[model samples]
Target chain A: MTAAVAEPGPTDAPLLRVRGLDKHFGPVQALYHVDLDLPSGKVTALCGDNGAGKSVLTKCIAGIYQPDHAEFLWEGHPAHIRSARDASRLGIETVYQDLALADNLDIVQNMFLGRERTSRGLLDEDSMERAAGETLASLRVTTVKSIRQPVASLSGGQRQSVAVAKAVMWNSKLVIMDEPTAALGVVQTKMVLDLIRRLRDRGLAVMVISHNLNDVFEVADRIAVMYLGRLVVQGDAATFDRQSVVEYMTTGAAGRPGGPRAKES
Target chain B: MAGALPERAPDLTAAPEAIAAELPPEVVAQSLGEYVRAYTARIRAGESGVLPVIVAMVAIMVVFEAISPNHVFLSPVNLVNLFQQSAVIMVLAMAEGFALVIGEIDLSVGFVGALGAAITVQLVQPLTTNWPWWAAILAGLFACAVFGAIQGTLVTRLRLPSFIVTLAGFLIANGLFLKVLLLGPFSGYPNLAGQSINLQVVYYLMWGSIDPVISWIGAAVVVIGLGLFMWLGDARRRSSGLVAPPVSLTLVKIGLIAVIAIVVVGICNTNRANLGTLEGVPWVIPIVLAVLGAWTVLLQRTTYGRYVYAIGGNPEATRRAGVNLAVVRTVAFTLCSFTAGVGMLLYASLLGGMSNNVQGGQYVLYAVAAAVIGGTSLFGGRGKPLHGILGGLVIGGIYNGMYLQGLSVEWEYIVTGLVLLAAVIIDSVSRRGSSSGSVTRV
Candidate 1:
């Protein structure tokens, strides 16, 4: 596959580094000593089967769940994300599968939901509309008929685009998407894959938790496969083919330790 | 990152014209014809807006005028009196709209409002405290707001359903209304026609009127101010290259407003009094307009209003956005009660007193009926203060026309119930249409 692999920068440190992450819910362990690195200008696809702890890891980074024992580094500095607000302050935004959008509100309203801008004690509709337009344009989202249209009137692809634009407009350095393309049709999936690439090109580190192998290989710069609540294999997309990813995702390993299917340094 | 997608560089820098072309024709509409076409398209797609209500109102008027004795239903005297009679229901509906917009209901507004008016009348009674009318009104509204806040707290803090909370509120306020009226110095209630200038002012709120010249000038000022506000705002947005309705459409809206104001002022100024004593617009018209204007701004142009709609539409989504849902919802109830106090004040003025005989239960039902019939969704998140006003007019029109025909009050209830059911059916059908293949915005 002709993956647009993002070249590593000269700096060795990554944008966000998670080390020895462990999470538990009551008696069941959801994640076990997982280490992950997300570099800027790259799309890292986290692939796994159901109950593989992909969602748990994404939630931990998003501050929705607190890992029992974990270390988080933001831009190579120690960072604590105890809540959603804390993660936002550190420039991390998450786009959940449900999108968390008010269907009755227009695009401009939804994009600025909690943090609406007001002037002279009223909503500055002109400024808000202009800003929303610019954000959508920057993302090359041209399918929407108008920025004032309510979100309920939008197609699945357009809604997904708006969700991404909402996340990217906040100057977030890292955006974690949970199954963005899971509900989209074929054409809509392509639209989202293009948008994902645009985010990477804009130098944002994106971690996508997806179960679709074709979507992951199409947009992801790096591949991380999870199995039985553990990170079984992670490396550049060039090092692992579709078969290797599937093998590691189900069996926890693909080949011998020294073989190319093993985790690459 | 720059070299990663060299082929996409030009696409990002595409010309503005190219981007503009990608938008729908309606977004870039440049002519009156195009604007009208777009609006018609929306109407066809089930965004009927207030059009259906207006049609219903017109139909009601025509049918009543054709059948009422001497066609008195459309006469200047009856029309002027109709507005005064409707003022109470209009304000109450506007009050209930606050809760309805936030996906909640306040069943206590009727008695809460009556209780508030009773407090005001009691305070201003010459045989009692003899307080200024303004102070009494303020004190009464404060009490109503406090009650609202309490009920709101029970709903928001304790996570109780607002229906049950406000239902309990209704019973408590009914009891309180009786108690408050007894507190007055009068045998059973308080009267407004007392020996005090402040009391006259309160009485004049519904029973009196401005001079003809002042009425004309006031109408002119209102029309011009509303027109200028709409035009200037839209013009500025257009100049800034933002999305705005076409200029012609804005002017058409202004023209419609001017026409409505003219008809109202013309009818009111025609000397409705058979004895040639009372004339011009009743003081209640301006009061009702003021209340309508304030609420329209509060619900349409403010962040707080947006959050109300958001919370009503999707509480989980709103909570995720970090909005304080409990505070917003509680405040909505407070405003709902505060506005209800104003409505009850008008009610007291209309009757010249507050007494235990007030039909608080019927008033509350009329409030809900007016709001719902005016096009507000009982399900919430999709209503306006204007709907409440129009709905109130329909209710008032039916009562006046039926009274002229010498029909009993039972017919009024039956007809209103039928109209309300029709409105709910229309609202649901339109909602379903808009949610599906319709092009109209939700």
Candidate 2:
């Protein structure tokens, strides 16, 4: 095991920097030498159509699958994460679109599912409830009427909030959310977008995978477009319009030349 | 411009608080009804939680008592008898609960229990006797433990379902039981008569009395200790910024325990006849209580307990959690079989000897029924050993009461089947309600 080296100085280096990452499933390549940097305190949107390899790249970073070849740079030094547990231990929490919340368990139980506190050799229900309440409150998730209510009773938007809060509760520096606003109503979508902004404002890096351009425009600070398992363009959110991103996402190259393409994109 | 905006609200309205206070009674009632609807909806969504099953159990008991004459069905002696008879069933149910908690089943409990008795008798008799009674008992238990471990390893390492593995065990164990029984019927075994062990030991444990004052003190101490542990634990957890059950819920649980203890003691103090004194706690009661405590702790308090629940809920999730699924699952099966072994020893003592042509299959079925009736989910990821005790007691009560009423054995079987079916149906309905509305959180 190599020693994990922290980057020098605060606000000096990107939280996560993936370089020359390649992944293959049998004969077909899923991700082709993808390179991207997720800086601290910003929401970076990874957008593409179906089969753009967004899910594949997200899973690799989340440690669900090991990349065939890649270097995961944490801070300024390369890091190796082999499992989801390892990623979690390194303060990287991923909230997949499914959320992975147990339906039978209530809000608090779901929030602390795997990492429950024990006192005197039993589940410390009081402590868990209080902590859950505090975490939800801190995240401004007030739509939930009761923490004791089962997660099944929660609406789609509330479930998303709970999933985010669960990740945030662990002091996660990098939170990856896969299509957080998918399959939600207009009101619910707005609530989730607000949550994304709140996560970034807390000085935490966020990587959001979404097909909804409206949501991307509302919350993302930076955009990375993937085409054919490779990031074709990367730039400030304010610099690119919807038409140019759509063009780049559908084609292998961006519309403009000598721009950020196939280099740092 | 003002018309287009529908005019801003006039400032002449009463304070906002006054407006809320003036809401209509019908509207408030409707809102209250909605709240209640939502609460019930949530409860219905979680399929395996405790409340719905508990309510059904109470309702069943009430209905039975109401339809019976003189409420004789609810008499103190009958209740005590119910507890006594349920002892074996409770032990067996707990054994099954352990297996079910890890999403498995133990089908060999009946034969395993018989095996324990057969071994105990053989060791204690003159034919092959070489050890004291205590040593023999320990040896019998050890043998069962080893047997359990073998079955567990087979299922875990070979990736076989426990149902199939234990079924095969059931056949092998029955053969062993028969072979051991035919080995010349060991003689001079303290109290052996033909094919039976002494009944005196069973009577002593089942109906023997302890000192009244001592029993009261013991019961009181237990209740107080439990209450203190719960209260203090809750407080400590709350202080540490963790989630805990409501304080009200804890108090309710403690109160229920106290009531149960006091009532049990009161029943034991009651005498059925003036000619013979029948007052005091039974030895088996304490033994069963001890077993319950130990097993409950094993399933709820240890890392092993977490692993079992995890495996039951989601094997994939547990695997991702870095738990060795095969090892934990096999250990659970082993424990289940070992407990069954203990139950068999006690059962033989109750009967005075191992009887020929024992229906091991029937007994195993009863054990499974007791567990399922007690609220343990067949699909796994939910259940506690405590359910075993409650379910066992209910079954035992029905058996004792029916026997007292001069019902035939066949009738008893029918009644047990019906009751088991009802309990299962209720469980299924409650589970459907709960799971549909909410996602099951670990």
Candidate 3:
């Protein structure tokens, strides 16, 4: 990890808050009263093993899957996200694991997509292309030679960047990415980590769900550990190391009464 | 957040630093030569464009010429015949192209075209209250569009398979064609036996021509207009820091188009007229050309076209993008049927009448075959209108060539079937290479 971790500044308010967020599938509970906070201009890493409810929490915020019960507060104002459209309307965007980009569309088309810039009766291609070029440049994503090349032709890392750019293209206040670097190589992963940091530096709240602890440690400022459908612990990233996260992920025993790190704390 | 600022904030307006300043930007075709090389590599890698069909067309010409007892393949009269025959199929193929590009099939296009012709005839003939020429044609076209919308709605709203919906549409339109043909003022003609009818205007679309001087002038304007647009558009793209094909390439394209246009017009200008010198290309040529040009612009330049390609490539993704897939998909079918109506006009003109025995099934098959043969994928997400021209030419060429050689109808069917199979095989194989194989990005 190159950058030091920091807690949310005292003056900063949480951009989004999830309290007692519970989701169940049939008889199984995917999330159990998970509480978390994402403040403006910081990165929160959501860590968990496969069934620890990371995806559920993300979907809840994204409005892809409604939580069975939860109080979702947006900028300290309670807001109900009933659909994906609602979440985006409230300036929340998610980059799904699959990216969900149209392979046949070029960068400009993919970026503007549902929100194309139309001048009069026709597509304002010049304006849209220029905007796309500027957006990529602002994000320092210059891997692609042309904004007109189809997303199908991009590398995994470049595709992830495009997805991230798409998430941030609108006036999104909070961006959640699910396993963005899972399909990338070493260099690509590094590129994405830099992009995440770039997003944070732009004063946007970012939440990343990642299995890659190295990447989480590299970019995440706040660490929230999930275990068995519950938020076991959360703190400044400095409070945990790779070993500690692994222990919490497996045993859910970070700082509970009489637990492993409780005595030391 | 202050501490997290990049050590060196990127100059957002400065020249973009590519991922690797050394290697080629992973996705651009930087120059004309590079574009060609990449294109060839893509073709070899099974991203089949119109290249294969083009080669096949040339081969068909050569083989037919070599095998024929006479110079029947390139005879100017036969060339004109080929163009006329191809017009209907080309229009139909263009119709199928819209649906196919969006990962759907309109099985009803052929019959829909037949019904259009039937309606046109019914409206124009004195057996009915004689409607004017343009009114009859417009009414026919409108009816066809509405019919298509019905099927499109059924498919999109009900989430029914387009193939099945349009298959039902095919049968319905087929029966409707007969009912339109056998009954009422359609073709009973006040007392004569039920017979086919063709309006002079309908017939003249294939048989008529502009004056030679006017044809030559129109040809010049069109060719020059296309060249200027390409040059200006490419230059505009370059100035905006976007990668455009090299000027040389644009010039070469213009040159090639000019050359092809010259040859075709020259052939038509020859004294192929059996009666007093019927010179100049058929009026239909220009109409077809205009249709192709307009469609190219629509597909390449419009938001609707973008949505079609996007839906074909990834329906879920397009939906996620907040696009109403139903509306886009439905409008696609309507547009397809509208084009099919245009093809029906051409067919009626060519056959000199709208006949009850209009082989609607066969027409739809040929339409799909032409689209696929021209390199539009049946698996979807990739295609162009230009492909209809190439594929229709090859299709019309085969039928004309075989007839010139005195081949029987059965042989035409056999060969058409074989050619269609070859095209589908190529599509499937190429798709696998591009989508599921080792060189995914290629």
Write down the lDDT of every candidate, Cα atoms only: 0.85, 0.74, 0.81
TM-score of each: 0.93, 0.83, 0.89
- Cα error, residue A199 of model 3, in Å, equals 1.3
Question: lDDT (0-100) at residue B55 of candidate 1?
Answer: 93
Tens digit of per-residue lDDT, candidate 3, span B367-408: 999999998989778889988888899899999999988999
In the range A74-172, model 3's lDDT, one tens digit per residue, is: 776678999999999889999988888887778778998888888776788877877777778789886665667677656778888899999898878
Cα lDDT of model 1 by residue, A1-265, tens digit? 1132254333668889999999999999999999998989999999998999999999899898999999998776678989999998788999988888887788889999998899999998877788888888888887665677677767777788888999988889999999999887787789899999999999999999998999999999999989989988788987788888888888888764543554556
DockQ (model 3, Cα): 0.30
How much is the lDDT of residue B267 in candidate 1?
94
**Which DockQ value does candidate 2 get?**
0.30
Encode model 1's per-residue lDDT on B254-308: one tens digit a residue.
9999999999999998977668477888899999999999989988899899999
DockQ of predictions, in order shown: 0.33, 0.30, 0.30
Q: For every model in order, what is the number of clashing pairs? A: 0, 36, 0
Candidate 2 lDDT by residue in tens digits, A37-57: 899999999988899999999
Every prediction's TM-score for the first chain?
0.93, 0.94, 0.91
Candidate 1 CAPRI classification by DockQ: acceptable
Worst 10-residue lDDT window, candidate 3 chain A:
A1-10
